[model samples]
Target: MSYLVLARKYRPRRFEDMVGQEVVTGVLRGAIEDDRVGHAYLFAGPRGTGKTTTARILAKALNCVKGPTPDPCGECERCLASDEGAEFDVIEIDAASNTSVNDVRELRESVGYAPVDSRYKVYIVDEVHMLSRAAFNALLKTLEEPPSHVKFLFATTELHKVPDTILSRCQVMRLSPIREEQIAGRLATVFDAEGVTAADGVAAELARRARGGMRDALSLADQLLALAGNSPQLADLARLSGGAGLQELLGLVDALGAGDRAAALDAVAAWAGREGELAGALLDVVRSIVVAGVCGAGSPHLEGGPAAGEALLARAKALGRGRLELMLADLIRARERMRHLAGSERVVLESALLELCTLEATMSLAELEARLASLEARLGGASVAGHTAGPASGGQLPVSIQPTPPPVGASATRSVQQPTGPATGPATAPGAAPRSPDTPQPAPGPAAAPALEPWKALVGALDARHRTLADLLRRSGKLQGSGSMARILVSKASADEQALLADKRSRRACERALSGAMGREITVEFVVGDAATPPPPKVEQDPFTRQVADLFDGHIEEP
Candidate 1:
């Protein structure tokens, strides 16, 4: 005897045996039990999702010798006939082959005839949407008012193709795709029944590859069992599904995380010549990584199971949420672009992958923000050595802060603690004994004046008269000093700022603004000394940046 495939051998014999479609089955079961079974019913959903199977089971339930029962007795002749697809009262038609008006007319004529032996004549039409417009029109009246003994069951993947006239008469029951876990569980049952010893992840991998089709999963399992015999390896399942092994997918992600371009490229190159859908496999693995990152390592969506979660969680964390989002976007775009581009799939896919691996070369806004956030956290807790704490030269309380010079063996806490008086009282004279708090306070110096808080007022005073000079003075240095002598330090200023401030006119306007603001003659001196603001230090490149620069044959440019 020829062997029956698992899809057929394990076909659901009753409504209770159906998977992932509780609502549809429950409604049908209730309808039969309540004796309110509709004369015409429409079962619509994707292929291999039990639309046709449900139709057969419904037919058996209506035609069983015991009665029109919700549960069919399989031992009954009518139930056995329905199971073998040879019931005289249950007519199964393929609308694809017989789509003409004549075929539909014949069907209408047959509906008037009584059941040969069962309780009702059941017409099960697969792909019922394929019927021509003329065929649908010819059958519309008969479908609306079929013989009381005749029950119609229509199954179609494309529901929209069926005419409204036909659909309005039928009780539409939509079936859903089976869940991955459900499919995997069923496959495990198949493995036990078939006496097969499969790897732990093999059934799960097959179920995922089924894309929510129980029949497809069972068929794949059967194919793998035939090819690999009773003991099927994980590699056999991987080969059957046209997906890379879990370890290979993990290795590629690891290469990306470590910025190992050669390794990443080698992995891609290895799959370039393979028969399987490499892009799809990579997409699935990447999707799992992203889901694991967002929902955590325990997410049920991780296709490779715990090993995948453990292997990819660190890499996901390392890539960060933003970079991972961009990578996923790039991957999706590459897949879409490949659909239209023939012979360029490898080049496009590899280029996109390389870009992800070397993301620093083109940091997205999110990636830049992520980098800045990390830097900010590190800087917030940082300490400087010998950092000075002094008021601005203008007696301006503190428009800007300066880092103290490193004092040997001591970390300096830079504070913006400004005194109500000048010079913080002479800086304690380098090594003099600390002054007693009760010691008489010194009188105000000639340069000491009430602090000018709004530096913009001083700058704006000259803005109307000398906009360029105002801009230069504004850009040139951190202001300090007070009445009669306003100092503008120029050492750390940019070359252009220094040159602009050095001009005689710009200096005179700055002096005028300072004097006006102080309500006294303020001599502005542009000084260069230890007190001058220091130029910003060059930022050291991180390894991620270095790797990106190396990959792109580029260097970091200063802004």
Candidate 2:
């Protein structure tokens, strides 16, 4: 006899035999026992989760010869015939192959007839989502009000494709993927029954690789058995699956954490040479590292043994969490790209390893802040010392000496000169103070009064530094004071510009500029009111255009 694959050979013969689907099994069993069955039922979920199998089981429960029983008597001829796919009343259709309105119409017409031998006629439609829109519409009425003696079962991986009109007519049960531990336990039973002496870790690895699909897990185990013959060990399974040994993957991670690029690259090369599955190996290593970081060193459930777990913990400590997160993100991106780069797998894998090796191995954010603070202190001390050294003995500091003020004349000095007491000689003129031999007179203040609080100077600095902000501030108005607290009165025309000045950063900048101009600290305030008259909008000239005009001996117009 030909060897039967484990997937088919171990197919669940009874509801009790189904693994990791108790929710579905329990519901069906209750419905059967209570005789509260629906005319049409829909099962939806990921593949290999037993949707089709459950449909078959339900068929057997409904049509068994003994009675309409929850637990079908397998010994009976009707149940046995259904199990062998030879039952006359039970019909299994692959909707993916026959998805047309005509096919559905035929099904609808056939459902009118009663079962020949069984208690009810069962129609199981697999991949029902593949049906065309017209086909679904044709089946809708029949599904909603099928003959009393007929039952309909539909299974699909893509429930979204099934129209809501069709979905509302059936009872829907969503199936979940089987858990890894459950798959592992089932595989353990299979191994024991096959008289195979597999290592403890082998079944677990296969189960994880299956990604919660029992059929996939069973198929993978069957493949491993063929390659290793009976009594396969964990090490043998790992080698066959192109999976790097747990210890080796951990060592590679440690090398990367230490910033030992050469060692890390060498390890990657060795794994690539042995496994020829670089993407898979990289993904596995990345997954292990992430798990170890999250769960810590004592997690017994990690796919690789305890040694791999410890190595991951050590790497996590050495590399720090920030670097690990960045590396994981990079690996995820590389894994996605691997799908499209069919022929250049090795190049992609090596590039990912090189990136990992050159990862920024660094301390946590708090540690980095502390290191920066220390460096800044050292640099600040050096700057202070450099400033303390005096100018060279013969050298002089550059002094910006203003031209001696023109002898203060009567006309130019009157507006700013304070009234003087009786002049000692020649009766000094109106706006000029007389200087006495024994007492010198103080200098007159500015003609324009130097802007009450240097608010105009602050605005000028802002204009020079940032035109956008300056324009907004300019429309707002003139300064009203020169002391610590300075206020501006904005006209209604520019009230909308207040939002720009309200920003904390902009306010602080205005304060600094005001302080610099007035030679004292200053606070800024905005008051809304009508100004005497708004200032004319300043014109902006492009520097490049001005330079070109200068070269041509022409003036550039400001707009």
User: 1-559 in candidate 2: lDDT tens per residue?
Assistant: 8998998888887899999899988998898888899988999988788898899889998888876787889989889998898989999999999999999999999999999989999999999999999999999979877899999999999999999998898889988988777888999999989998887788877776676678888888888999998888877765565345555556676665544545754664565433235555556666667677888877755654576578777776666677788677877776766667764444455555545644543344455345444434533443222213322222221211111122223122211111122332222233232222222232322311445224444555554333444555554454544224444434332222332333333455565566566665555554333333232222212222222223233211221
Report, for every candidate in turn, its global Cα lDDT versus the true structure.
0.66, 0.64
Worst 10 residues of 2 by lDDT: 410-419
lDDT measured at residue 131 in model 2 versus the true structure, 0 to 100: 96
TM-score for model 2?
0.57
Best lDDT among the predictions, by candidate number? 1
Q: What are the root-mean-square deviations of the candidates from the true structure over C-alphas?
A: 18.4, 19.3
Candidate 1 lDDT tens digits, 431-548: 1111222333223334433323224445554444344444544554445453344444432333223333434445555655555545565555454322333322232122222233
Clashing pairs in 2: 453-481, 453-482
Residue runs of model 2 more than 4 Å from their true location after superposition? 241-288, 299-305, 311-364, 370-559
> Total clashes, candidate 1?
7
Candidate 1 scores a C-alpha RMSD against the true structure in Å of 18.4
